[model samples]
Target: MHAGTTVELLCRLETEPTPDGGRAVVVVEVSDHHPARAVRARQASSADETRGHGLQLVGAVAESWGITYRRDLKTVWFRLLAGPHDRVYGPPARFSQDDPDLQRDLRAAELLAPAPVRRSPARRSDADWINHGALSFLAEASDLLSGQLDEEQVALLAAQLVVPRLADWCAVWLYDGGSRDSSGAPPRLARVWHSSEGRIDALRMALEKDPPVLPVPGPQRDGAGAAVPWPWPQEPSGYGPGGAALACRLLAGGRDQGALLIGRAGLMRFPDEVVGLIEDLTRRVARAVATARAYRNQERISQVLQRRLLPRGPATVPGLESSVVYEPREGAWAGGDFWDLFDAGDGRWCFALGDVCGSGPEAAAVTGLARPVLRLLARDGYGVGEVLDRLNKTMAREATDSVAAVAAAVAAAGPGPDAAVELRAEAEQTRFLSLLYGEIVPHADGTAGARCTLASAGHPLPLVLGAGGGVRVAAAPQMLLGVVEDTSYESESFDLAPGETLLCVTDGVTERRCGHRLFDDDDGLAGHLTACTGLGATAVAEHIRRAVHAFAATPPDDDLALLVLQATERR
Candidate 1:
């Protein structure tokens, strides 16, 4: 059935009802089948093996089956008796050798015996060996790739995994993303290695001295080839030639990220199966490399952008110590969370921690605008409430204009498939921010040595860790900014004696999740803060960061920013 379905034989099926059940029979006849040898039969080599087991299966499932042949035709037949009353031949003893009927039946059965079958070696398909080896290799490769995100490590792993397994020598080269050469110039060689550890140095030197052999554009444009033939021309003492080579294109996201070159010396030529296995390996490697590159690039850019948005260092103030920690979510392109500290002169220091409502470049733009504007207005002598009021008005105005612009663009684009999506997003136009801003004014107090004022705009209340290891939220009244024009905010004043600490963090800290439970406001953040009351500003900030991260089962889903301020001396 697996081979084909065309046949020249005739088949007949008959059935008859019985008192207990039913009886059925099937007969297949082949007439003058040119070569009688084609009709020979043999028992299956094993019970589990399917070849030559068709009659055996019928005999077991259907009560009886036999073959009879004539000079002009061969008829094969099978019968089934569904009733329990009938007992057919039970054992070999039941058919005595002395009986004439038994002898006649034995003679007839001998005519159906199969002639000697000429056994031939089974042909292996290209996928058989590849699937067996590739399954294990890919599993190991996946584990290796997951353990590291650096492209260099991935390339090194690829080279090492292929050597001694798929090749005697292997080398991996990656494109120099930062190369300043013209596009036509060859890609810079990033890695080169051979199977023998002792011969690695010599092989590397030869590779370095020779110009890179870029693959010619073949049927596949991305690139696939061995630049130089094996058997080192310069240093052939340790290794000899005649080794067949393979070049696999490292393609990721439809682009050629790199190439893997492998060589086998002597008689170990790459079969089609091995070549297919290498191709699959290269495909996985390319995807991993591409992902690693993209992640690294994003991290670099995120660091730069975040640094520019936040102050390089904490605000310097007399009798105060401050520390901050900011960690962006892994793989996130934009950091909506931001914090800043800058001295506003005259013994007053302004600091703020805020989170934009969204992420990506759009949220980054809003953050850039908000952080600097807050600092500028505070330095210009605006009170905490007044600064937020003005900032909210500015955000509201800009958001309105942005919506109008997007709407116009959508209308101009016409009613295409993408246009409706754009229109919907623009129509929603929800851009807002949760902020906690405050001005710390140094003053003397009898019980509390130093005093400061804090304010909020729909932000989490600050946690004040007392000198004696007490943690409680400092309450304040507020509304989220950028949602409405002319929004007003209320301030709360709290005094911190020496050794007391003020811990303020974005929602990314308290909202972190562990399974179904959240590191919530009442118990989670406050509980961690109580344990670090006497710690210095930097230690307290780091403690909170560690605690929140430990509580989350997975990596933080949003940006985390924390600001810690400690009263070191009396005003």
Candidate 2:
């Protein structure tokens, strides 16, 4: 989409033997960075009809057409019955606008295109009305499918998208291995939809006994735009008019994602245009299925790592109450942010709240190494500053190892096309950390109050809430960890007077934005805490969490976490 961007282009034409003349299938593929979506047909204003005629034009002339997507490539293909072989396709001897045949073809193209091609107001029905508005159906289908992240939801939506419109009933069968040919498992019937609600179960049960086995798209196989005839079920009365039934493979990312089946009771055979439309819908469904599967796999890993990183509950302090609120922003789990609270023995309790500079598996690796090392140092009797100083060294060492490993990988990639891209991607991921680490010691009475020692390293300063509703900063900020080695850190020491509260929050809370205004604009966090002076630690945590969410109409875009420590007398 930008100047100097390199994209591979490919074109292939294949001929298929047919009872009626020959058939030609043309496939065009191009490299793409973004996921595939339905072709968009924008509303036109003036008489000029060529402006936004993207895939709409293809939909007009092609007898059957569909789209397929791989990880880095997208293929849009169309099929048409071959004409007389002797017909010459050379350049016209003299081009003229007055040609009658040319004029006829132009009219046909216009008439075949969806209603928006001929009229400005083809918005005859609501977008959800299937098959009536072709443009709206495609645009809405893409919007709905592209946003789904569950495989089952994708299957359900596919079945509902076709039934009661193009067909009397539709059913979806998904391969657990994403390959119907897999030796491990068989295709599973995921969803079934029908115009009559009661027929859904009967249809599903009948279909389960006979799963369709379609050929994988290949040189010998028919084009992806084509569907094979499937047997009609007549076991139950009224199941079919014996009209027509067809099934197509849901193929994407170079494998069969699933199969789609649909049947109409009255039609002897579906029109080519209708078949092409269903083919396009199948591709979109396949792409959505692939995306949902990828996300589900990642979610499984993220939740597992997140559980290991965060504690179930903060350790109990003798004279102080502690509560924590942690929420990784939607889809940003696995090292976006982490917090820990544990007892280090010797009447000392250790607490930490931190954010990684990057995200994903790389950041998870850093956080994974950081959390356990923090516990090890605290248990070894390292004071607050001492623990941070040692952890910084360990993080620096790990960062060096990571950089070296990536450099080695780049070298192994050589000067090939992927080398530079790999290096740039690796360079953008950092191991630096912003952290708030502290030690808590209850007073000798074990209920009067506690002594607090804490340090902020390139992190938001902690706030101390006084008994009389006043607030102030607790620790001064310093350099971030994993960036520089042997950095001497300083900890602020203070008495946690009875009934006072300490609030330490990650940047997710302080930097929450609503337009140009931030949640912590003009000391807003302190102001919010000022109102929460007399509440318990849990209440203060909940109050602050709610305030963060209420600060903006949208949810926070970054991982949010906070720690609340309240000093109490033996309660």
Candidate 3:
């Protein structure tokens, strides 16, 4: 009865006449194509946990059940008899242990176990434990399953949760994209667990040889009737001697992710209640699987986008030690902060650090456009100031087109008057940028220091740290890029003497928050750079980076980027 097993049910009610009163008999028969676990029990009760749970519940209440079988159908039947002499007046009091029905239930328990050990005294009252511990177990299972973002890890957790609680052994099979018939990909065994850990591998090998397959249009396709009896594994011997097992499809959001197969070492047939519990677990597992896959896919796409937007890394700037730190905030596909250092023609090296106004694909678009144009202009011998002027004109033109596009899309949706304001705000967000651009020329003799020319466009001013710990601003701030095409930019020039460092950063560092205080609230970054007078470029960058992180108990929400350029001694 693995997965696609067919089942049928029939009911019969009869009344027998007596001298004083009549007795009524109600019988139900459940038939299936294969031999079932409910029929093998000679006597069933609460202690007979291996005997099917449905039969145990029926046996607890019914006065007597008659065996009804035919050659054509494999079936089991339960009969309930009520005579006029028994409780003919009022309903039996409370359903506690003092009731007659419960007293009879105690006798049924005795039939299964002369000495029954109970997890709860209330459960010992009748066959109620069939539904007992189920809620608490599912809650714990959900807690364990939540926040899991790896499919294989979800499978492992599912197996561990079920073993010893719901089954003696458990196995999880995962499909790559869809089930075999749908995706043409066979399911892979993701995890196998057993109460006794030693038997897992052998049982897994056995199960793999003949894993249960649920194809299209089966009962597994729908949510109801998710669990079906599965044959016990025959591999490595002794598994099938006196055990029962089943496979339940793991489905969520109308997608089939995998299957959960569970086996009990000493059960006749899996109790229907237990099957229901496993079915619920399968649903939760499927959801966890879907969630994990979604997270992985987003991470992958972010990676691909990042590669397309940024270079492999910055290049070496000769005669000067250069170090950079870039940390994108977590859970973001792309960050606003970006930096590049590359060789320009004629002993000139070009470097720029810029921050887009926003994040994700929008920021990615601007980043993709800016870097190549900057590199092309610098290599063609454009000075830092001239490059900014030309890049600003280009950015302004792109911004106008972007705003027009957004307006068209928004207008096409036929929204109300507020749409105009929304369009303006969104248009303002694209292409607007804060940037610091610089060019360097070594002393014409490959010495320790170089002449630095730089400008800032509404960006944090660069700090110059001398070997003696004095800090000075390297450049003054100007209008931001992409804001106006008619604006002119100015550049500042200075000699980077040996052992002097130029520090540049995006807002992420200057605005890092600790309580109400910012990292650079009152020239704090300058003060920190003053403390690293003797450190190398990398050391200075890392020290300032660590200090910024330690300033706040909470991790920085904004993307962080810093570039350190120190004039070094010739090797």
User: Which regions of candidate 1 deviate over 4 angstroms?
Assistant: 1-128, 131-148, 178-185, 215-235, 249-256, 267-270, 319-336, 358-365, 394-431, 443-453, 463-475, 492-503, 512-561, 564-571
Residues 1-571 of candidate 1 have per-residue lDDT tens digits of 2123232566676666679755665555433333123334444344234343343344334433334433433344555433433667575465566888765533322432331121112222336635645676677667656555688877876876676556667777677662211134455456665644456666666655643444445445443322333333355543446467776656654455666777776644567767767777787787778767666755565456566776678868667889999887887766788888888876688989998877654566567777777888888998888899988987777754544453444332222213343434623443588899988876633333456777888887898898899887776747888887966876778777788898888889878888788887458788888889679999999988989888856889988889998888644
Pull out the clashing pairs in model 2.
447-569, 447-570
**Candidates' TM-scores?**
0.60, 0.68, 0.67
Residue-pair clashes per prediction, in order, are 0, 2, 0
lDDT of 3 by residue, 137-247 (tens): 677667657757788888987986776556778889988754444466778888988755446667777878876676545555565427888876766352434488888
Error of 1 at 107 (Å): 66
Q: Model 1 Cα displacement at 476 (Å)?
A: 3.0
The list of candidate 2 runs beyond 4 A from truth reads 1-140, 177-183, 217-226, 234-238, 266-271, 330-335, 359-363, 399-427, 444-447
Report the C-alpha lDDT of model 2 over 1-571, residue by residue, as the tens digit: 2223345667777787689956776655545444434434445335544443334455455554445444444445555445766799997687689977667535433554563453234322223233545665677678768878888989987886786446778988888864554435668899888765546667887888888777666755433635777777765543565677889888765567778999887667776766777888888998888778766655565567677787878888888888998888876756468899999999899899998887765566567778999999999998999999999998887764554453444343222213342434544446788999999888876559889999999899999999999998999989999878979999989999999999999999999999999999999999999999789999999999999999988878888899999998775
lDDT of 1: 0.66
Predicted model with the maximum TM-score? 2
Give the residue spans of candidate 3 off by over 4 A.
1-127, 130-132, 177-183, 218-225, 235-240, 265-268, 307-313, 329-336, 357-369, 389-432, 443-449, 479-490, 553-555, 568-571
